[model samples]
Target: MNQIKKWISENIVVLFFCMLCIAAYTIAGQNPYVVASDLINRVMRNSIMVLALIIPILTGMGLNFGIVVGAMSAQAALIFVTHWRLTGVAGIAAALVMCTAVSVLCGYLLGRLFNRTRGQEMITGMIAGYFGQGIYLLIFLVLLGTVIPFWDDQLSISTGIGVKDTLNLQEGMKGALDAAYKLPLSTVCIIGFAIFTVYTGYRLWKAGDEEQKAGRRGRIVRWAGLGILLAALLVIPVTSAVIRRCSIPVITLIFILLVSLLCQFVMNTKLGQDFRSVGNDIHIAESAGINVNRIRIIATIFSTVLASWGQFAFLQNMGTFSTYTAQQNVGTFSIAALLVGGASIDRANVKQAFIGVVLFQLLFLLAPAAGTKIFNDSQVGEYFRTIISNGVIAVALVLHAMHKAQENAKAAAEAEV
Candidate 1:
């Protein structure tokens, strides 16, 4: 009982997420398969954006509210793709190349500005987003068909001097990735679970070894037991569900998993180590002869470039883009999703990102139906999710601030002692 209590305490946030999901499922009473299918799709679509946040966080830039700039860059490139009538993978590739170039420039400028105001990166990023939005508006709303040479009647406004408010990609590039080969959920789940079990066991064993080196006895057994329990908890029910013969977009799933794996791999490289050191203490890193500013710039550049590709993926999957407003909340919801997954301003990982996508999309999937059931209005659900998403971000920021305050106070007390 005490062990269960301790586990609950350690995982209170995840527990709350589970409880909310249960409440949503009960109140909404939606089709289980439908929910699962939607959850899978949304997870693949949004995970990249959320994962993009990890690098900036690792470089000590906080939540990187400036990712919106990268989203904007992608949106701009998307306009050209739509205008050129580029279709399928070709369209996505063009937007990626264009967006990467734009994001690199934006990230470099933003990084240099952030260096000028070291501790204020988040605020600086937020301001830069707003500032960049203004420029974005000028380019698309005014310059696109006017100063720039765009000639697509379908994409441009009737007045022929700007892009339209919304661009549809159904005929051009929708489902390009999702239309690839399908896979049985059971096979994928088994493979996934096997990987999870081995990885979890290895992590626990390493932790146990570290504890032993520090003179903590019996930790190995405890860690092994805990890891086994966690692995079972994740695998058993999920495997059972998979055996029901559901299907997934196998190619898209593989791509997402590859991206996740790439993120983990990057963390083992020299650049990743520099990101960690700078993240932990920029002053200390500088004293160790690291190029602190250069590392930070690289981090932002990677984050921006990743966000661009993520946005491109999102646009292709959704089949439409609201030119004026599509990217506005990219940073907001991605950050909220990351925080929902158990990431913080200072630390995040791919597993947390995927988990966060699942949990966040679960709420997104059920909130409307639940709202309609209780209030007799489906629109309530839409409003609820919007408010809740922003609310989660606000709550996370406050918690981070409070945690920092507590740490500072503890350090001061220890110094006095």
Candidate 2:
């Protein structure tokens, strides 16, 4: 009972959204294949950006809205690569290298800005995003052809004064990553299961006798569940058909997997523990000889770099770049998705990031259909999406404030005792 209540309290947002998804799915009446395909595509596009927010949250910096700057860095790289006529894998490799360079510089400077702002990191990040956008506009809009001396017939304006508002990436740059490789979804699932089974077995093998005994029941239940899932994946014809119909973007999915694993791996390292310490209480962490500001800066740098890579993946998958507008909402949507996954302002993880992306994207996919079904207009769904993305953030902030207040009051009472 107590445990159940605690679980409910922690996961209330996730549960609420899950219920909403079910309701929307029922109303939408969409085919499973279409939904699954769209959801997978969206997951591949947005998961890395969502994951980018984790390090900052762990190190006590809020959502790092400055990720827009990183996205901008990627766009700049993409533009240069396209201009250079680099094609296929080589183009992607060049763009990534360029993106990383820019992201590192931007991240380092942004981290310094964050260190100065301290408690106001979130708002500072938002301002930094706007500030960076201004600089981006100045360079791309004003200086590109005038001061920078760059001109391409396809990429530039009619007068060659600036880049075009929309840049077509048909020059072997589009789908460069996503189209590189593909794998059957069923095979992906089998591989996933195999990896998990090995990991579980390794954990059991490494456990002490007492620890193993204590967790035997839980381990048995988990193994049973995995066995059933694997069996269904192999034996159930309907499940097998659905899985077979889906094709995973092998290269893109591999990047997402690497990022997910990196996030988990980082959290277990000594630096990651320092991040947690700083997040929990900076004063205490400082007293313990931790460099709180340095930790925060490192966290910001990691987030910004990841966001750059994420935006690179996003544009490659989409096959076009909107130039000025593509990066504007990167931070907002990513933050909202994280919040919807049951992460608080100060706490987040890889699992929450994955769960958030799936749920958030599902709702996004369903909203228009459900709206059309009930209201005879798809626009209502767009409005609902806007509300959901912003509203979730507002609600989470309020809840976090309330939680903090309660904690403070409890501490006060203990002090009195």
Candidate 3:
């Protein structure tokens, strides 16, 4: 009973949002299949971006509002990709590669800046995103044709001075990465193989066998082998899902699962231990000989790179880009999604990312319909969603502060005793 109470106290904000989602779903009276299907797709699409926020939070850096920088980096890559007229997986791959490079560079810089403003990382990130957007607009609007020099007439304005306001992926990039293959049977085989690899790894480690005797080096090699195998399995399914056109985003779900598993796996590594240590107490970690600044930088880099990929994944599916504005809300929504999942200022995970996406998106899908029913105004639903999403984030922050305050009070009382 005490445990249940503690859990409730910890997750009150999530529970409240969950209730709102359920209420909205009930009131909307939408088809269950459609709603469920939409929710699943949304989760698959948005979860990665949210997952990207988890690592930085785990490192005690708070939610990475600078993920917008990563999103912008992706959009910049896609523009050149569309200009180059690269099609199919090649185009998407090119974009991913480009975004990865850009994000890594940007993440490294941002991480360095963050190290200076340590305690204010979140607010600093938010500011950096806004500042970055200004630079993005300047680059795409003014610098691209003149300074950057690209050859894609299709991607530029009539005067061929700047990039287009919208880039349609349907022509070249839509479903490019997604439509790489069609092997449902192969997908299942890969999943089974991945499961087996995991099981085998667990058993071998448990047995303290020859592999364990080799220690971290052997474990690293084993993990590398397992990761490669699992990645191969992911390819079979994700590529196949596009071809099969399953009701659910089967391949996308697999992608999310892979990412989630990767997130968990990373947390168990030495780096993850360092992150936990830094998160717990940076001063202590520093005294313990951990490179606090370096770890924080690495965390930001990972978050930015992952966020870039996540944004690209989303854009490919949507088949269009608003260019200038697409990245603006990326950070906000991703952070909100993480907060909605019951993640706090100090801790988060893939589970929170998934749950937040589901609950938050459910309310999003249902709000307009429910609003139309209740107020005979669909716009009411729009306002409701906007207000609620932002509201939930505010509430979660307050709850986090309160929880921290309570903890401090309890510690002080214990000290007095």
Name the lDDT value of residue 374 in candidate 1.
93
lDDT of 3 by residue, 170-251 (tens): 4667755444443444454566667766876776667566656657566557767877865664468654444234344456
User: How many residue pairs clash (N, CA or C atoms closer than 3 angstroms) in each of the candidate models, in the order given?
Assistant: 0, 0, 0
lDDT of each: 0.81, 0.88, 0.82
Q: Highest lDDT: give the candidate number.
A: 2
TM-score of 3: 0.84
Q: After superposition, how far is residue 297 of candidate 3 from its true place, in Å?
A: 0.8
Worst 10 residues of 1 by lDDT: 211-220
- Could you give candidate 1's per-residue lDDT for residues 243-342 as a string of tens digits? 4556777767777777777777878899999999999999999999999999999999888888887887787789888998998889889988888777
Superposed by TM-score, candidate 1 places the C-alpha of residue 85 at a distance from the truth, in angstroms, of: 2.4
Is 1 or 3 the stronger prediction by TM-score? 1
TM-score of each: 0.85, 0.94, 0.84
Clashes of 3: 0
| Weakest ten-residue segment in model 2 by summed lDDT | 395-404
Query: Of 1 and 2, which scores higher on TM-score?
Result: 2
